[model samples]
Target: MNWRLVFVLFAVFAVGTNALIMAGIVPAIATGLNTSEAIAGLGLTVFALTYAVVGPTLPIILSRFGRRTIMAGGLILFIGGTVLSGLAPDVSIFMLSRVIVGVAAAAIPPQAAAIAIAISPPGREGRALGLLSAGILLSIALGVPLGSLLGIWLGYSGAFLFLASLGIVGLIGLFFIPPTPKPAKATIAEQFAPFRRPAVLVLGLCAFLFAWCQYSITTFFAPLVKDSAGISDVEVPILLVIYGLTGVVAALFGGRLIDRFSGYAVAIGGFIAITITTPLFSVASSFLIAAIVVVVWSLAQNVTFPAAQVEMGRLHPANPATAFALFAALVQAGGAIGAAVSAGVLEALGPRWIAPVAAVATLIGTIVISLLARRLRRQNEAQSILVEATVDEAS
Candidate 1:
């Protein structure tokens, strides 16, 4: 195993945690900032929104720099943002800090994906990507609960300071990482070419729609679970643990699924499963039932990511990092919209309707993408047969 790559992944995992787990401590943040919970939630909403917009642009702006240069610069921005956010005296400044983090947040997945794919081989792409995805799941598993605990113990500001400190640790770990050899270079327009491929376009659309549905409900999973199951506030962290742990297992298993069946299938099928379960989540009467459903949903969600990534690796086999980066960028784009909509859903229908509504959207997107996948598969098979026939004729 490549230790440098491992370090890169560890850094990525830690950074992803920083972006994602802040919401878990939002209540604590509200208290610290002397603001309403609603206001604190906006911090997340704003970061995601800015991250989405910047995700695409950042790669382009930083193209002149080496991947190592970009990654290091990005980490510095993340640590700076975290520190500023930690010290902010008011809610507005706190949000501004989050935006700084968002700028750095866009820089992470590309380097992480590049590192993961760089260290692996062709046939094992799915497995490698799966393990990388595992880092993401692991962070969720560990980061949120730990953050919540820190918030409760030392206050939200202290918790954020710790998070910033984690960013610095990741940066140091990343410094020990060896720089990846540059792949074939592309102009901005060339980098954007994948945007026009039918398969890529379809997947991008599917991602956005899927995000809209999934994020709407997931943003409020803790509260939803608590309310649905009548669980005490203490149980939220434990249940979140359940949710995160199951996702880790899913990452391990989902990689095999991708390696065997192809990433396209895993991507489409996972979303379908999520769509099917959305109703259950929306209406589960018992905490245990909701927990079970959330676990399944989280598992399925974990699979779709690596599956899509493995596909991206194969799809743009010539420029794997760029492919993965574009996929990561699209995820943020969809997430931005999804997160924004979730706030509206939370306010309008009391969270009961969000999952089902998202389910319907996922179902719709799945149908279109599944059809496209079939068409792509058939085209590939037909081309294979033609090559074989030509070889036979030559013999």
Candidate 2:
């Protein structure tokens, strides 16, 4: 494990922490801004939507720049936006600050992953990406709950301040990371060309649908548990910690399985399990059942994330950055759509329906992924034959 890879992991984790903090502390933010919880939740939608809409395009625009330039500048913007979020006096200002943070956060992860993969030792790409994925699980496990506790003690603004400090630390670490140049061989048209492939498009859709399932409930996880199960604010962190711990285990193992098996297999299996387990959450009326459901949900969801990245890397081995960028964008889009739609559903149907809806979404995703994987196999077989025939002719 190179120290620079550690820096990249931390950089990604720093941004990821803020995104998940809404899950644990939406009530605090709502109260601080004197807004409704639904409106406060919209802050997440804003951040996610901005990240989704703007993030993928950024890789293209910034492709001309070095990773050092892109990461350093994005960190500065991310840190500044986080500070602004801490100081925001109203919901409007808070949401605006989140947008800034969202766009800034969007630029860091794919570039960091690209650099990490480039420097990764041979046959260790899965392990390296696993570490990167672990950063995300750690943020959800440690950072979000801790931020919630901080909000309980210091105020919601204090939570933002803490997140800002982490961003600043990541910025400092950015300086120590070596520069990586963009792939000179990928033409601009080819950068977008992968989108036309059924395999890439389907995998991206899987990323989208999976994210939708996770974030739909997660954006409001704490409040829902409190309302439905009567869990106190003090117990919120514990529940989230359980979710995070389970997720960490799943992510680490999922990485190895993705290396041993194919990402297609892991994703299909995980998605089917997700479809089954997600609806179980709707029926979890007791704390113990809810906890179990949460753990299962987290495990199912977290395991597929790295697999999706691995699948995307396989889709375009020569341009992992581009592949990861598209995957990240779709994931963010799914999150944004999930959060936004769930906000409406929360107003109409309440939290209990969140998991059931997620189940339906994942069911759809499972079907599509299965079909896409079959198509990908056939395409690869045909290409193999073409290559063999070409070789035979030459001989």
Candidate 3:
């Protein structure tokens, strides 16, 4: 294992922890800020919206800078924003802090994945990408739960502070990694060239849809679990850990599967699994049953990330950072929409509707992506046959 990559993974973990910690601590935030849980949950929506808006553009604007500068700058801003979130006296300020953090976060993960792909050994891209994706899962598994405990003990503000401290560690670690040279400047048209490909377009849609499905349920997970399983705030983290741990395993294993099989196949399998398992949340009447459903859903959901990332890298080999930034933006956009939509559903229809709605979204995404993948495969096969026929005729 390259120790440098480990630091990159750690950096991703810090960003992801901040991004997701709110899911575990939303009720505390609601109470502390004198707002409804639905309103407080908009903190995440704010972050995702900001990220979706900024993620694609900022990285391209900063394309001339080296990865080290971009990563370090992002961390500095992230730390500042997180600190603000911890210190904010009102919900407005807290939401503003999330915007700042989201902007900063926009620059990190896609760059981190690009760095990983750049530095990884040949034929191991899937594993490298998987390792980084696992950082997000690890944050869910460990960081969110631990943050929840801190929220229970100290306050929601304290949880934000703890996340800030992690960002500082990632900042220091960045200094030790080898410096990456800046790429030559390119025109805006060149930067957006990947969008011209049909495959990239379909994949972006898949990214958006899957993220929509996943976050719709997860952004409000604390309340959903409580409503469905009679679980308390303290117990929410335990189920999150189970979900996260299962995701971690799936991410690592999915990476190898992508390496051996096809990213398209692995991604489609993941989507199918999610579609099948997510609706089961409606029927989970006991903790054991809920946990079982969580484990299966986590396994299915986590695998899609690495597989999509690997496909993105392969599709835009010359400018992978651009592809990754686009994918990240779409994912955030979907998450923002999902969170906002689900909040309305929770307020009106109740938590029972969240799972079924999520499942429907995933099912739609699965069908669209599956059709596109099949077409792409057939095109490739046809091209191969044409080339072979020409060669045989010449011989």
Candidate 4:
């Protein structure tokens, strides 16, 4: 492993932990802010919406700077926003703080991925990307559960402070990393040129759909488990730990599988597994059954993300940064929409409906990926036939 990638992974872990920790402590935040959990959930929506809107543009706007400079700047902003979140007097101020953190977070993951790809040893790009994914998974496995415990013990404000401390650690670690080369300046249109491809469009849509499905449940995971299994607040973190640990295993090994098989194969399998297991949430009558379902669901969800990222790199090798930025933005947008939609569902129909709705989205995403795979296969076959005919004629 390149030591630099380790720092990149650490940076991602810090940022991702902040991004995901809210899901685990929504009730705490609601109680602290004197707002409804549904309103408190809007914090995620605001953050994700800001991230989706700002992420792709930030890289293009700052294309002149080295990757390290941009990432370090982001971490600085993250720390400030995290502290502000901890001090906010009301839900409105807390949400505004989230927007700041979202913009800050927008700077990290895509650049981290570009750095990983640039620095990784040959044929190990998948593993390298997997490591990046693991950073986020490990954040879930470790950070969220810990944050929830802190929220329980200290308050949601304390949880935010804990995350801010992590941000400071990530910022200091950034200085140790060797600076990455500056990207060439490109016009906005040129930067977005990859969107012209049909495959890129299809893949982006698939990313959105799957993310929509996944976040609908994940944004309210603690509440969902509580409602279904009658688990206490403290036990919610245990389930999250279980879910995230399984995700870490899947992400680390799923990269090797991507290298061995194709990204398309792995991604399709993941989507299918999710579609199957997601609806099972409706029937999870006991904590044990919910835990079992969570393991399968997390494995499917985690593997799908990295595989899609691998495909994004392959699909737009000429400018993977743009592809990654766009993918990240769409995923955030999907998450925002999903969270908002699920909040409405939770308010209207209740928690049980969330899984069925999410499953439908996953099923649609599965069909989208399958279609793209078939198209790519035919294109490869046609090119192979053309090469064979040219050789025969020459002979």
Segments in model 3 whose C-alpha atoms lie over 4 Å from true places: 23-42, 88-96, 152-158, 180-185, 222-234, 344-350, 389-395
How does candidate 1 fare on TM-score? 0.87
Between candidates 1 and 2, the one scoring higher on lDDT is 2
Clashing pairs in 4: none
Q: Per-residue lDDT for 39-133 in model 1, tens only?
A: 98888778877777777656655666666777788888888888888789998899899899887877877766766666666566677777777
Model 1 residue 135 CA deviation (Å) reads: 2.4
lDDT of 4 by residue, 278-319 (tens): 988877888899999999999999889999888887786655
Kindly list the per-residue Cα lDDT of model 2 for residues 1-395, writing each as its tens digit.
77777777777888998887776688888888889999998887799778888877777777777767887888888988988887889988999999999889888888777777777776666667777888888888887667768888878888888877777777788778766656666567877787787788888988889888888877778767776677777776788889888887887677778778887788888898899988776666778887988888888877778877877877876666677888999987887788778888888998877778777778989999899888879988999999999999999
Query: lDDT by residue for model 3 over 194-258, one digit each (tens)?
Result: 88888898899999899999889888887787788887766777787898989989888878888
Off-target runs (Cα >4 Å) in candidate 1 are 1-3, 27-40, 89-93, 226-230, 339-350, 386-395
The whole-model lDDT of each prediction reads: 0.75, 0.81, 0.85, 0.85
Cα distance off (Å), candidate 3, residue 322 = 1.6
Clashes of 4: 0
Ranking by lDDT: 3, 4, 2, 1
Clashing pairs in 3: none
